[model samples]
Target: MAYKPPTRAGATVYVWSNYSLQERDRRWKAVRESGAKAGFDCIFVPLGDGIDARYLTQLRCSSVVLPTDGRPPIIIADRSSSNTWAPEPWQTSREWSEPMAEALLELGMERARIGVAGLKGGRVSHVTSIDGVVNHGAFAAVMRRLPNARFEEATDILGFARYIKSAEEIASMRKAVEIAEAGLAELAAAARSGVDAAALYARVMARMLELGAEYFPWALTLGMSDGSDAKRFTDPPLGRRLKANSLAQTEMIAVFGTQIAEEDQAVLLGPIPEAWKPVVARQREIFDEGVKLLTPGRSCAELLEFSKSVAEKGGMKAKVRLVGRGAGDDGPVIGAMTQPDALKELTVEKNTLWLWRPTVTGADGKTRFTWGGTVLVTEKDGELLSKRAHGAISVA
Candidate 1:
């Protein structure tokens, strides 16, 4: 599918901090519908964020959110404490925030209400940080710059944004999905009698790169591991080897343009595991049940109750918390509607996008087979984003 810009736009949003050129531009283009509504005239990409002001000037913009516009400034500083492997050094430099504030003020932004958002990725540690990224101090400094500014705390801003995808964002996600599909197809074809897990991952990742993915959003995980072991679903490269007849499960993301599309699939290398036969059947049953449960005007709590009943009937150790989630901004908005703190009530709105996964434990005491796919919740019905076959396990 060809990429189409969003019919809507954003408010005077500024990508004022340090981000790669591809990422910034992709984000800007994907949510054009929302940006247009917010009166998005120009996206002020700082010279430091790998964007050349001269090249940017040639593009369309209402006015550059730079310091020369000379008005009260509303500076926004973004920092995340998440599982990112690398520290974005450009963000930590003390002097970065001040200049951004000045530039916003100069560009006619009302300095009175600088807003900041802080995200802390899923962390079990008692006193802060995911994979070592933190920004409490950075956020505080931005607050000092604009005393009256308001702030919001989000565990995952991009994750939240992803749920509200514009047409452009949807197109980007679809493109990423295509690349992932192609790479995985290549991976399946290349599998041999005794391929190691590391070798398989390297091959798939290389294929993804060849298909235009700049980075792998998540590390590839392989083995006959169950869903319980799926906690570390994404892992960095390692020396894990694959068993001859083992089932290979991979959860990964393709970084294309500004969006990262997430994909997960499993393959039976030589012969299907006998233990997995019934498990796979149970997965299909649950998937159908979940899909049928998705109708407009249904409460999130109500659907969860129904899902729970279905899980119990199948003799699965089903937890509603692992159900469906929204997939938009950063990737998929993961959460079970059954949780007491459900992100949003059911009441599926037209055009709302969701990714739902239902899993069940096997007789062998592992989360062996599960199924999920991204779909659009329209007024009429549900439309799947990344289509996959139901009932049949993908055989290599």
Candidate 2:
């Protein structure tokens, strides 16, 4: 019997999860190198969405014990369904702790130095979290079981490795950008005085998933504010509809397979007040100038400072966070507010993906503007992946 690929109503669709074995090896090589450099014999990963778990084992929806010796990771899936998603010849279980410790012991790693992921905030710059996201019960269980093993913080082993995009990762990110643009286009076309903002968001989500977004990100940030308040994003009160003069915006993230791309979406429901036009224009100018600095080797601090100075000179305050990593797990999220010392010293690297959402608020504070896109840092320069904004989607 032949396995026929699934299709939707006689239409052609591209499968977005294709990554070559070599690409997988390339990622593994990075993890191995990072571990070896850190003197880690194994890395203990707990339950997470498709993060390092996906990068190393492809079955990280559960937990993983990745031996630094190039051996396949030992997995404990959150559900039995994970078994279907992982490649063959590997085993999965719903149990944790006992099974996990057993794998390390079997590998003669009970006394080996192990790196514990989620121990502290190393994924999105150690600045974002004073303490990393870790499951204490899981850690305690292992501590009790593997009494002789040593543990150390190992988040960077995966963080730095994920920062560099492989050829396949870039392709998937591009596709995610395409899917996001498709949704943005639909949202723009759907925007009008009478539509419900929530309804509009529903449409956007449907379209993205139809085009192959992995799932509906439940925590999507979207909002609509009517005149004078200048609130960029908010859920409309029940039964309220978009007024003729309104601003609808979203902090959108589109996921394709494990890759992601993000953008700031805005739709103007009516004409801007005469006084606000120049302020908006100046905001756009700041964005235009700031984005050019996305090239590799550019300093994150320098870019943020440039944005602040330009925005201030142009009559607005630059957003505290200018950009965020936009790939699997979306880490190293930088901003002055969270971790200033480290963010200011970071450098943008080639092939690193990002979502640049540069925003500014006018002197009155209510007159705000945002123009953003997902871009890839290339050897030559920053390549824009999203093509949805020419400022904001205007209905008037």
Candidate 3:
């Protein structure tokens, strides 16, 4: 998909997350409806852990509380902040207490039903560290300030709506994927040509940012290991060499604006062993087949069962965490890795995005030869959003 520039009809554009004001209005309205369904008068998006608020306000870092009555929302931010393409329909406060409480009272929400995001949404929403991303002090102070108001943990108010990705969200994700693959290509080239582990990892990040990426969020691995053990190094890759019989791999998470795209690449340090050839081919088939099943209207239970069935036939481990897990900012919002039951009820919806990595392990359970890329769910099937070659790269 090609990237489209968002337009505002002669309005002051707030350099927000590449979304138009009309899109913002569409999202807030959706949140308002979601809140109404939850019997809440408003939804509170807290500081530091307020992804939902950022989703609503489109501000860089959002402290937003949305009301269901169509009244203006509340935002807390640094007054000195500049060059922000902030929203128009919201009021602001300096912090989440005192002034925040006053704003709530003035809006006639002093004793109203307020839904708090991230309170307990660890299992369901983008509320991660997934256990409670809300700040206790900020929420507690507001509780003391509005003792009469009823505040409930309501991550779903936003979670439900977030699962349904808009067209604009998909476009941003495509851009993020573009940025990630550019960096991944660099790593692949450097690996074959003999690059230092530290220098290789550093260069991949540098390349991604140079290509207009917002952040290189987390995760990196560059080590020569003979087995399937994903050796996570705390020490820098100072002397790690990309020599024979070893692998240099990384599951890169590249960011563009608020969207993230992930892809795993491994450069083989030696020739392919004879015993691993069949396993590699079979896993590739399984991965390609499975991606097609990631279609709209498919139940999670059905997909889980499908993976399990194929894993049995192919002698692969049907691990949920490793096989398929997602619905990131672009899809599957209620995926609780701890709770499998919720996933059973999750129906695959269009425009949801996830990281699907299918690995082929040999007898030693180490040597995983496979491919991974961010998949975008469409009406027909899963779309691999990467331009990288679809298999493990082996160098003589």
For each candidate, what TM-score against the reference? 0.64, 0.85, 0.85
Q: Native-vs-model 1 lDDT?
A: 0.46
Which runs in model 3 stand beyond 4 Å of their true positions? Answer: 1-16, 82-95, 122-124, 127-130, 192-194, 228-230, 233-236, 314-338
Better of 1 and 3 by lDDT: 3
Lowest lDDT sum, 10 consecutive residues, model 1, at 81-90
RMSD of each: 10.4, 6.3, 6.7
Candidate 3 C-alpha lDDT tens digits along 1-396:
111212322223233366777777778889899898888998887765656666776565556667898876766543322223353323333344654565577677788999887677433365344566777787789889888999888877777677666787788878888988888778767775455677777787889888877654445555444564356653337766566656766677777656667887766766766766776677778778778888999887677666565654445443323222233333333222434564656777777777777666655566566567888888888998888876667766
Give the Cα-based TM-score of candidate 1 against the true structure.
0.64
Alpha-carbon lDDT, every model? 0.46, 0.66, 0.66
Q: How well does candidate 2 match the true structure, expressed as C-alpha RMSD? A: 6.3
Q: How far off is residue 226 in model 1, in Å? A: 9.5
The CA lDDT at 13 in model 1 is: 30
Worst 10 residues of 2 by lDDT: 1-10
> What lDDT tens digits, residue by residue, belong to model 1 across residues 20-136?
455434443433333333333223333222212211121211112322122211222222211111122112122444544454444444433221222333211111233222234
